[model samples]
Target: MTTRAAGVATPRRAWLGLAVLILPVLLVSMDMSVLYLAMPTITDRLDPSGTQQLWILDIYGFLLAGLLVPMGNLGDRIGRRRIMLAGATVFGLASVLAAFAPNAGVLIAARALMGLGGATLLPSSLALISTLFPNPRARATAIGLWTAFFAGGTALGPIIGGTLLHSFWWGAVFLINIPVLLILLLAGPFVLPEHRESGRGPMDLPSVLMSIGGMLPLVYAIKEIAAHGPAPIPAVAGLAGLGVLVAFVRRQRTLAEPLLDLDLFRRPMFRLAIVSSTVGMMSLAAMSYLVGIWLQSVRGHDALSAALLGLPGAIAVFAVSMIGSRVGRRLGTGRAFVVALTVAAVGNLLLLGVGVDGGVGFYIAASILIGIGDGLAFPLVSELAVASVPPERAGSAVGISETSFELGNGLGLALLGSLAALVFRSGGDFAPTLGETLDDAGSDTGLARAASEAFVSGMHVATIAAAVLLAATAIVAWRTARTQPAAAVGVSAEPVGARH
Candidate 1:
């Protein structure tokens, strides 16, 4: 086995291993959105209640977010490859179960199992990259590819789902994972190297429980509030989650082998990177959700057509992600982030001009701009987070980085989505969402027009809110990057591809 040393170049085997690792990364991200087009079909067949349908859609993400930290730490203690392979096996089996599930409850259970597996896949796969590419510049390039694939997977989910549902059943989406995962399982042992920290003690069960208890309730509360406004149950759950998380942090500080290392946050760059990532992802998720609704509800496009319309933006994201690190090298990481975020902010601002009647060209332009910005920012944030820590602690760092992303996605949907919903309700006696409003409006042309106008108003407000947030984040990133030198941030000062 070759040791990962600073001066060493990345081997051909490492590139081969990266190809192997990409399979699970792609699938894990795709699973997050693959159900969007299939949901109506699923609902019709399973006849689940409104709440049950929501659970079926949401449980996977909730469980995945809740378990990421614990699983990351677990991978550190055990072996990243081992955890990753086990996760793939479970994910594959769960996909089979979900594909064949006859009832809503069974499907929900299977999705939850898939979440459990996904938690392992994301962090372990990212951390394993550190072992494969020890050179910081090469590592940055590899991480850029990783980020690209992940973004591509997420963007492709709807298109792929729409295509699958065109001829096949809703279950085909889940079944498609089987063959890809089978490849991962077959080639993983031969190509991927195992990595674990030496001399780590047993995991703290209480910490694991606390993290799960804290995250699940918090995430669920966020989703509930976004869906149905502030209720007593979600309010209490949110508060309780916060309390437990505070306790969890304290316990980590006191532990000999903490589940999460709090000291990592001591580095200002790491903290800033996390914040940037969170805000970037938040804007992306909120915009994606809003735009998807707008296309189907207002523009009256079918699922496949809407997805196709959005394809160029997705392609832009994929392309920018691949070159993000190279851009960072030219401009320097800090300035690069400023430029990227500012561009995204501009994109969000463009959405304010879109009207209920027509703005297809404007919307497409906005999406491509947003895609460029997010694509550039995401990879750098991941590279910075991983580079901020020692190799042995990479899994934990990746977990934290990824957790920020998950939380950001949830928060964007909750906060911005709720804002839009509130605006829609205030305009008239409209339903919480545009879809429901149109469904209720039916053949009443006046009501439909009114509802459409109100929904567009809500979208504008949400879009502006997203824009303001991005701009504010950009200013903060600029200031922070200036104050904190690259070396102090646990990153090398040399330009990308620089060698000793």
Candidate 2:
């Protein structure tokens, strides 16, 4: 029996709810990676500008990151379950629109709406786990499983999308979500419990607007700088975004009930966890693009073939997340994450050796290591990041971490993607752009070989940069573990009363 009275409810029914909660995350995570292989198809069909192409990839994350805080807090005050249901509806509707969108602008808008729906879904599911599990160790394990499904979705996206693309059209990926949404809609009310912060003040509408305004501009600046190099417009956008952020921070100080826990940063584990997860996620994001290019651009593989190449890495990631939980429990959670980061660094460094002829075998081997490292590290960091706050504020805590992930994905596309692009252009063996690089190489055996080799050379530099960043993140995590020393793993295991 799991009682609702608050002191660690041990309800058997919560496991069923957990299964239900995994649905939204599984769908959302799949959305992240599924579109990558489909991008080339979209480009051909939509005939978008370079900037528009980036927007189609980025807008979902941008809108989702910008709205997370407001949405998370809203869930806290009104109810997590209600917010989740509303988001599911939005996500389902957005998926249909995105599937049928005729132009770049409409597709971008649809993706942004999906992002909005994601903002509501991701945090609520994670937060609910905080209340459902009573024992610390069990909670940690549960968090690991949640991260596993999330990881699995990203891994499976390519194969699933690839298979669909092989047989059908690009829109088939979006259409697959319809049936999943129906299940969530019907089962959610029966198993998912509702939680709300009763004493919390009304939602801050102005703050919500400010967050979106500030983030949209900042991300625009970053993306433009990547595509066209620095210019006056991007510079102005950057400053304006910074100013808005400052104003938002000040506004939080004045509000009787702030939207976020401004003081959450005071905890060392909390701060480091965000930094660690964001950096790790950034590497993964960069790889997402590079892998697609490697398959389609360099190897001349179709979309399904490209997506299939990622299957091994995806399996490694899902396996690590599922099986590493016990190992993480045995080791201090902080130390486990640090070890995983070190492993990931080693994996990134291996890319330095890849050449034009670097066989699929080489790529697969490197990807497996990278996948295992990320799979092990990400979940531990996420669990720590959210668990640092009080149970009641779980939504806000998850919102902050999830925001970092969204921002990292965007930044990865801009920064690392730009670095690789720059290196590719400077080779002077081919034209400055990928389109011309391929066109100029067409029908000429020597030029095509040179172009392929040049692209790999660019990848070498990007890999070095990624390795250095991962090492730095690992060092930061290591030092924090040395000093802070985790308080306790599992305090007590108490069962609660509830109905099945």
Candidate 3:
């Protein structure tokens, strides 16, 4: 009964398939933040050392970021559906293992396995959307929904985790992913279509190795620097990662079948979209991290209470993400970027008025503004990235776009988070994070007050820096939009790969 129009699948089937695909996307994003509220309980139960605890919290993201590109390519050569189903199996089994892990080491290993599965799920699901909805307008809508689910999952993670932790054991966080992923595993084969290049060459093993090597070290370096500030080990690892990436790029140029299609960067719109995605994510992630700390540590709200207060912002993000593409079409993509980023910058500036004593209203209002801006911008970036490439190369293009998101998230924490930490340290000899500072303050009211003031001061500086960065990026987006024609910025139906 299904029909095709200009080779695009029936809308009903495509939309149904999209529903199946988003299951993994939601789970993957949730896993990233779900641990936030559960960490204390996990520590109490597992008796992990500081280093082990860090690994349990971090290893999943590290592996997930590192493997995204290679896995995306793998999906292109094989089949997106095939890889996705396989990944779901891995992810589901790993989640179970993590839930029942007897020790910290086992949990770390299980989390890493989940990351490996996640890498496959993200890009494959996105690329599948490109295949499913070839019409430009439909594709934009699909990506917008994808963006909403992603943002919603991240926002819901702490709230969901806190809710589960109140009644169930700490392991309930990991257990929650099972039923959702199981639905994906069962329904995906029936609903999703298989898509792959007909004559793609075998994957370049060396390129894959180089990518993993470069990305793992680079992400590790960023995380280490963020957590403990600059050290010799992280510096060396970062330099080494850079060198490997340079070599990888050079190797790609020589290969008859490169792992990544480097030529995608030649398109101005593609390049601009990647940069926008990176910077936008960076600013959003930085603000989210700081706000979570500010609510819990400075405002003395419990995890559940703070999450409840932030729910309205989360709702704003989810609501706006659905309508962002329509807004872009009405205002023009360039003007849309300008308006969105400016709104976000204003939100960041509003944080400047927030204080240790009474800024709950300010914080809530600022979070909603920031959420709206991010919701309006992120979907456009994803759509542009996929639309800029040929159908056959959507997977590669999506890989780069998703990689930018991962890197941006890490860099935001490293760079801006580090800046905030420096300002806090300058105020006094204190622990690296506000939580630790308050914990150590004990009954010392004066010490707690000083720590709170210092934390707010640091948050103000970081938000100002974030606002400035967002404003600058918005300016660049404006210029890019003006120079490029409607088609160049992803408005036209023509594939950018054809132009090159």
Candidate 4:
């Protein structure tokens, strides 16, 4: 029989483990935003080419996507805590290296290392939560906390970065990870339980390689297309990547332990959730990145000012998301998803009115809408994704959903961000007075500011694209919601306990 604790004792270890699991999410989301602010600072110091700049930005997500499955599988085989701690350690070290790096190339390399570490961190942490919290109510509550961290991180990045920038430099943004990781390292071993995969199958090496080969090239090609329109290199790379992906799927069909279980998509709810999440990310992620640049570069808002504009969204997300699970239960999950998507599309359209001349109020209002939309949509989508699989395969399914999120965010920024850059460069639009003033600080600052206009324009392009994609997704999800059988899917109205 299981031992029972007396006198209202809660499991401190499990709660601490859950906190450790969220550390990576906090770091990754914060860093992603901080870099958008830091880009102007980085380019001023480093003088990287436009392409190199995109690489520095896109590589982090690309590498994260490329390695997530294999690393996630490895963690399952070895131990989730062991893998997560190892990842945290690597990430911390990479951050220190990035902070002190002298050249752009070194910094880019360090960021890539950080990405690999991040891939390990996300899947392992998610799987650990799944393993720790087996009860549905506990799992929902735990996942709710996890979702809260994501929103918090997204909102907090600029505040932290702005503070750091005032006292230090761009590198400080990276350095901040060290202290967080150090704390995790000390606490993790003592508090987090070790859990290992119970299944028996060889890790599929060939499938892993094909997945990496296919995804990275495709991501790279897409980034290139965004940067340079339909360039030959991107064209060839895109075609090659697609072909490799097709072959990878074919190989997965025969493999005993496939890196990604393709059959998961056969479930209508799972398929719809992934598709909707991708489109959501494609829209929201692009807008988030672009909005930062537009605020700082075009509207001349400081880091803190730009972050403040987003405050309404963050607050709305926190407040609205509290009601999301209930709403999902009330409306039916698919119907709830449709409603959320529609609201989000409207939010994106609202952002179209926010121009360089618009007052701060407009931007803030737009952010609130976007935040509410996302707040409503993301959790529902996550709920649908998690509920799609049997409890036994939950770990793997969570990894897939996380992978989609990371890839969607990366692709949104790369493709939409790049298109904005190209449009601005082609138009030759820069604020001469602002350019002169920035130059007065130094030549580095001048070049950086000059690049800022293109960046802002790029952001606009991304916002527009995001809006279009979200609108399309809303239509698709609404049409598709009719087919889902209510009996096959269960909605647990009761509160979930810790996904420890």
Candidate 5:
């Protein structure tokens, strides 16, 4: 049997590799929200058709979600470093395409390419860090920083996008990704170590096809339902998507090398971590998109002003995440998760105060609380997910968990935002502009007032939903705490490629 080096050093190359890998997270997460703030500008200049507009906005996430699992599995078959470099190169090239696209169709295609690259970048980077940091404590710290930048990207993207749009066209958002990708491409080969299993497993082509087919329809149906009020076309598509999903699951069971290990979910910690992370992400994503509209359409804040208003949340997220490790240790994982959810629930309640009557102080306080709760919850959830799996399977575990968060972010926004729209229609407003929609219904007074009230109502409902999900997660986490010590070492003892 071949043994490997233990207690890997924190070499300069390793640190640089981490930096290079993090660029994708920043790019991906930034793109997720960057477009939200830029939507008004894009709509005005591009004058996109209804479907084209949604495509331009959502294609990145849709493609990213569809490809992540297959891409991760592929990385395991090939060398991770090779995949990362290729992904970085693709990402850079795609950014240029997006930046200069003449029409919405080209922009949508470019975004999809970027998402393809992102799927490769995300899982490969996490795997690289796992290979480089063998020590558990050191790995946790590294992962914490990694996770921080991922979260930070969402917060920072708007700030940067806001600044860019103030001077340049909306395309500047895509332009910004170029330099980051270039940095990764240049630095990756020298800095990042290569990782591949000793023997390559047979590729799961059937699973990949089924997954892509299943995810694409479902995501598209959700986006359509969000926009078009659950029409028959989307309804049928959603049901068909369910059928494809069932087929995918059956295919996975028959595969010699499954793309995703469904059995890992049998582990309690894995279940809780995925659920809680999904809920947290869903809540954050829904709110982030809605709040931008609130700031600009309702609150009458400019893009720059709206971005500035959101700074408190960004700062709070950074600060809280920095201290989360200590808090997790002190409170125990279950207790910490429950506490974080409770705090997030309180933050949501504060968002209820964001009526037309709210002042700057109200927005600041709400943003800070929301940001801090999300910051604290996610890293702990990520830790629990990987710790539940064996070191060798850590990459798969992490990838699955991250994928769940991304799907949840997209799904949550669709469901909650759609529900809000439905509620609005029932309440009587049908104006073309979002602000006017609220105004005619008497839910808001001024332009800013309408935006604030609309957001507050939508956000309140979403938060209540998220809080309910977290409450369930808390129960699961409590059960997980009892099994953690055993599971951590238990998983480590298992050999690679062994089914859970």
Candidate 6:
């Protein structure tokens, strides 16, 4: 173990290391974007059924989210850099496999493998920053950069994929990953220092299995319920998942060395931070999920144009996140979130005017506002989540935080997005999904126009629901901030191994 002055400024080497850490962030996000943009192409080539296509698209996120906590714990137990390097290796190989798969099943298998590799990369990269930047403020800034780059990769994914798909095959998008992974593999161990718990106990297999098992079914249940309305099996699966998670928690309470230190939630600050992050991310995901479809399916834009529209919002997130720490210092984390959420609420409200008519201006305005709000608030919550734990246990803590973000993506799509679908179909007969609804309206100009109008109606409902959620979150944050204890320590100078 090593120690440093509590207030020591981050060194140049750590900045360099931060650059290396952003690779996985970009890789995972870019991969998501490319997959999304390449879906039709994949379906065309693989000729998968609707269910198989859904699995192909979602399995990556599902497995990645499910394994995050365990993988984060694994990194803490073994070593951050080692897992990072290993994850990158696996991710690169999986990309190659996915690029040239013989069939849908093989591609699904390859995507699941990519999910494991993604799970390893995120928590390890985030936790490594704790070791690198001992100062709380510097760490927040670094996280801001990480968030910005993540937004950049996501925004670029579709753009890049569209370009590649135009000139080459869908595999070209996967090939783009090869160079990035090669660079990360070569630069990582040389630049990023290894960090892990010094006295980790025996590996806890039950908890590991429980965590993965608990998450997989729960997420699948949520997605299925959203996609197909309430059903007996998913509802039962959800309950069963709840039971497994309860058991997992019970075992953690009795274990000498818990896989995740459940005690961290004891702090009000940590708990509040997690909630804020989850809800904030939910808003972001719901926005992207809705607007992406709204643009293409409703507004009659190409995927490339829709991707272009998303770029401004992504840029706003990057700009605001980079400066978010300063905003937090001025307003306090709680107030910063409140303000950001209000902005987000307003952003959502602006989109209430988005319709089958000419309201692209309002949509674009809403995009910038939402981006600004997320930029302002996202770092504050994430920074607090990372700061709440000691660097030695950083992987697990950050894993929980990261998981909350993934949960937001899952739940936002399920809850708010589903509600919108329900509202749209309530008035008349409609297809199961927006894409399907529009696709079924093929060649009938009136039906296409009517479908767009109906989808916009749903979009309005979703955005309004989103706004209410953000407003409620802001109020809760206000109360929490008022009562938050000042002793909420983000980090300490205890002899954690110094990043060399």
Maximum-lDDT candidate:
1
Model 4 scores a TM of 0.88
Writing each residue's lDDT as its tens digit, candidate 5 over 191-290 gives 8888876565777787878877888788778877766666988888888888898999888788666888887776655566677777777777767776
Q: How does each model score on TM-score?
A: 0.91, 0.92, 0.91, 0.88, 0.89, 0.89
Error of 3 at 431 (Å): 3.0
lDDT of 3 at 148: 89
Error of 6 at 349 (Å): 2.2
Query: lDDT for each of the candidates?
Result: 0.81, 0.78, 0.80, 0.70, 0.71, 0.76
In TM-score terms, candidate 1 sits at: 0.91
Best-to-worst ranking by lDDT: 1, 3, 2, 6, 5, 4
Backbone clashes under 3 angstroms, per model: 0, 8, 0, 6, 2, 0
Global CA lDDT of candidate 1, please? Answer: 0.81
lDDT of 1 at 285: 69
Whose TM-score is greatest here?
2
Worst 10 residues of 1 by lDDT: 491-500
Query: Scored by Cα lDDT, where does model 6 land?
Result: 0.76
Give Cα distance to truth, residue 475, candidate 2, Å: 1.0
Q: For candidate 3, what is the lDDT?
A: 0.80
How well is each residue in 1-500 modelled by candidate 4, as lDDT tens digits? Answer: 12124332335556777888788877876765667667767877886766777677777877877787788777777777888889898898899998988888988899899988888887777666666665555555566666666655765676677667767888999989988888878988887778776764878888888888998888888877766668888889989999999999999788766778777676656666777767776666667767766777668787766766676777876666656666666776667777777777777767766665664666677777877776766666555545655544445566777777677768877777767666766654432223323554365655555565555555566666777777777777676667653412234321111121
Which residue pairs clash in candidate 1? Answer: none
Q: RMSD of model 2, in Å?
A: 4.2
Q: Pairing residues by index, what is the TM-score of model 3?
A: 0.91
Candidate 6 residue pairs in backbone clash:
none
lDDT of 6 at 323: 80
